[model samples]
Target chain A: MVKSIPLTKADVLHLLSEIVDPEIPVVNIQEMGMLRDVLLSGDSCEVLLTPTYNGCPAMGIIEQDILLLLQQHGIPNAKVKLVYAPAWTTDWMSDSTKEKLKHYGIAAPLHSSCVNWLKPDQITVACPNCGSEETLLVSRFGSTACKALYRCNGCKEPFEYFKCH
Target chain B: MTLQEALFNYLLRLGDNALIQGHRLSEWCSKAPVLEEDLALTNMALDQIGAAQAFLKYAGAIENKGRSEDDLAYKRAERQFFNNLMTELPIGDFSFTIAKQLLLSSFEFFLFRGLSQSKDQTIANIAAKTLKEVHYHLAHSRDWCFRLGKGTEVSHEKLQNSVNALWMYTDELFEMGEADEVLMEAGIVFSLKEIKPKWLELVSGILDDANIALPNVDYMQTGSRKGIHTEHLGHLLSEMQFLQRAYPDASW
Candidate 1:
């Protein structure tokens, strides 16, 4: 058997960049802000991941992806640790990531989730297809925990909105 | 109660409430009034399940037992559960669910806000994460209270009746025991009584706005402190734990 070559923390982080969100396949986990940090110690490495939503089933798959990637790279004793202190926020997502989501037919979060829940009518998301701000709230829940359903009056298309939080 | 015992019991209460409530909400899947509402209820169910997992996992650790979250969840008996009485009641109807959720979410809003500052790091972390999710549940429930409570006369009457029927269980949500007092002294948890006023104010605001009157409950149901639960819990557990019980240690 060939001897395994160890990967540095940076190398592991780079490899993990390829792991995409299982539900929203358009963007990677890193871009979605679920990949928080990576720490290497001696022969063991730990990846810090913050879940998008505490109940998101994608978290289990993300952890499996991290372990699989590490094993493929011959990294030993690597583990994924979920941290919830500061709590994941939409503010961690960049504008480009938002654009990617929009291009994928899902309207990105309009406001930072840092803002508290406002009245349902106050939240106005632009339709990704028609670029019209005449979208109506369909439901606060969508196909996944991270999305909310919306309907665009301009194009009369129902779309998923990446929920702010 | 010792701090360890108090903390463990407190976590059990939190976990059991979420798990039972989630199970009830999940019963609405594919059965809600509409598709969007169906998805919404199940989404809430998913959030509560996740929160329940965290709390139960921590509780198992606190007990220093070999049991995992699944063990605590699937292997436990009805008498071992510590969920609030309100959480275990049968989902009577859409109006009943909306009324119950309004009360439950409002209480959790204040309860979690207080626990977010917990002296224990694990409890604090779980509370903070769950607090974020609770915001949406609270908002949705509050909005529905208005929709059902102030809609047609039939809708308004249904909601009012649900509130009156569920009023007795509401007090159990705030009832305290030895564990609560101990946790409060240790700073691991704040007094449920401390947040009762806030919980009442929030609930009363929605009820008042929706034209639903404050329920005049003469006496409140109790018993979660002693691991006692409604008979509904036994039946719920029987169905929920059937697979695990029938196929012990079965792996997917």
Candidate 2:
């Protein structure tokens, strides 16, 4: 075999950072914490992505984007695998992503140890539109599986928020 | 049957329902009336397929079968399927499709809600995850049902006809079999009888909001729980299993 330059996991992660989510274009996979793991052997790369939700529609597009990103960088034998174990949660999102989502007019998830829906005081989701702590959930579900419908008391605009599971 | 066997069969029905319905919806990918609706339909179909994969994987594990989700979905024959008859019906017009979705999602909402409270942790976890998706699907279908039922006269008439034709098949969904009995006894699954009243109430509320009346005809019950499907399933399987049958080991 001709001398093949070895690739590193860091290089693969760098490449995946270029793949932005299709629905939410402001943040790339890395920012959203969607890129779970990357392995590299010689010139081949394997990327792992955790879906936002169990049946997220953006998953297919994200996989394709990762493939294209690697292929463009001359990594011909790249493979993308989806791992569902240790399931993804809003808690995995980075601080930058939280800021970006707020700036993009979507409420970022509230961090809470309690998963109980009956305890409203325990879960406090900040409003993204007007930076208000006074927001109410309009519906438990939103237009998509990953989001919940909410309205801000400050801005009075209904917005979608990624629910913290 | 053991609790494991009952759980496997129950998961199989859930997976089969989603897989068959997803396959049916995918047939309309490029043929939808508008681009947005097309994307929406395909997105919904993909969601169902993903849910099927989760359930099928769980079922395989419960059965101690080394089969993958793809093997369970693609390799199974029509007679081996255990989905309710509502899932396998042809997607006629937009109205008919919406009507089917409304009925199916309403049933699924109750099913998942009940499953979430199961004594089995794995089954409850899967149900909790799937309930979120089914909630959105129910809302989407309910919205469309309202629009179709109360919109233009032609739309109303078409939607009414679809509901009337499909209402007869709704009883099959709540029909319990031996597997259900075993699961219920084991607390691995809830009794469908317990879910039926909620399903009826929610479905009726949607119909009432849409200004559509429930058909007075007696409900039809099919033996899909026993692997007997409607005539449409044969044609559907022919198309769905074509590639797998042609080249057994074909992969891209």
Candidate 3:
């Protein structure tokens, strides 16, 4: 009889890194920091996820994808739980993913500590296209709930800024 | 009422407030003055709906009933709902919506801040998560109030009228009843008395910045906690509940 090794936490992490966020195709859940923790005991795997935003529509899809990916990896009894403690912040997003987001034409979130949502007018978001600091907020919300719409005064192009929460 | 029952009722009030207000905001999805503003309002609506689901789900669990969030939201009769009267009012115009947002978001900003420290872990968790969204919502409406209040004669008149028209229902926001008192005793809920002063201060500061006068009113509307609502709520419920009423157990 041939014996197969059970999946470890590192193995689970490696698999999760492949699951792309349906909303932002360029970034995976791991890179987005939505995948918080994984507990694997035998074949019963448990995954904990935190939504990037409280009402993020992508949560359901991400949960399903994680389950399917785990199942495909021969862990059929995996459970994905959504938690909201120490709440998910833009600061969790990896630098590489932020670069990928900017390259994808959606300006990534500024570091959480640097964001002052209260004084939005005082905050300057450089345009992804022209790299100009003269972008004006067209709206506090954008195409997605987690982003803000901004128009570049220099480039004269409208773009999405991944807002800090 | 027993402590459990009181807590259940309290949760309904919180959930219903969010659900009804979210429904009203969704009405502006395609009708906003600008596309960006349309998205913003709808996004806020989504946030409220999500919050409502969390609260209602918790309420159902506490009731020890088989009911789910949808069952509580769509299956409840108009009289069974406990949302505030301000939430059921029609979204008359941009300024009207802005005026409503200003009042409710300010109220929620403080309410959630208090609830975040509640003895109940579930309530505290939900409150802490929601407070983040409420912060942005308040800021959005506050800035708009400033812009519209100082924009032009027509804009200022519209906003001022909105404030006056809605002021009658504002008092009911702080009207705590037996359920609230019971929950307050249990530390499951906090007194609105504490939130009232902070609410007034924050709202007044925004109104002052907006150059809008505070409405001078005496006779205030009430009864939402007891499920007594304006005529508008029934109509709103009929439209909102239409889908679930027609196709039971439908899911995407």
Candidate 2 lDDT, B65-128, residue by residue in tens = 6987877877889898898998999999999998999999889888988888888887787777
For residues B7-119, write the lDDT of model 3, one tens digit per residue. 89999998999999999999998899998899999999999998998899999999997899989999999999999999999999999999999999999988998999999
Docking class of 3: medium
- What TM-scores do the predictions have? 0.96, 0.74, 0.95
Q: Mark the regions of model 2 whose C-alpha exceeds 4 Å error after superposition.
A: A1-50, A57-98, A102-165
* DockQ scores for all predicted structures: 0.70, 0.20, 0.61
Tens digits of per-residue lDDT for model 1, B55-158: 99999999997889889999999988999989999999999999989999888888888899999999899998898788888888887888998899999999
TM-score of chain A of each: 0.92, 0.88, 0.92
Q: What RMSD does each model have against the real structure?
A: 1.9, 6.3, 2.1
Worst 10 residues of 1 chain A by lDDT: A112-121
Distance from true location, Cα of B34 in model 1, Å: 0.6
In candidate 2, the residue pairs with backbone N, CA or C atoms under 3 Å apart (3 or more residues apart, or in different chains) clash, namely none
The DockQ ranking, best first, is 1, 3, 2
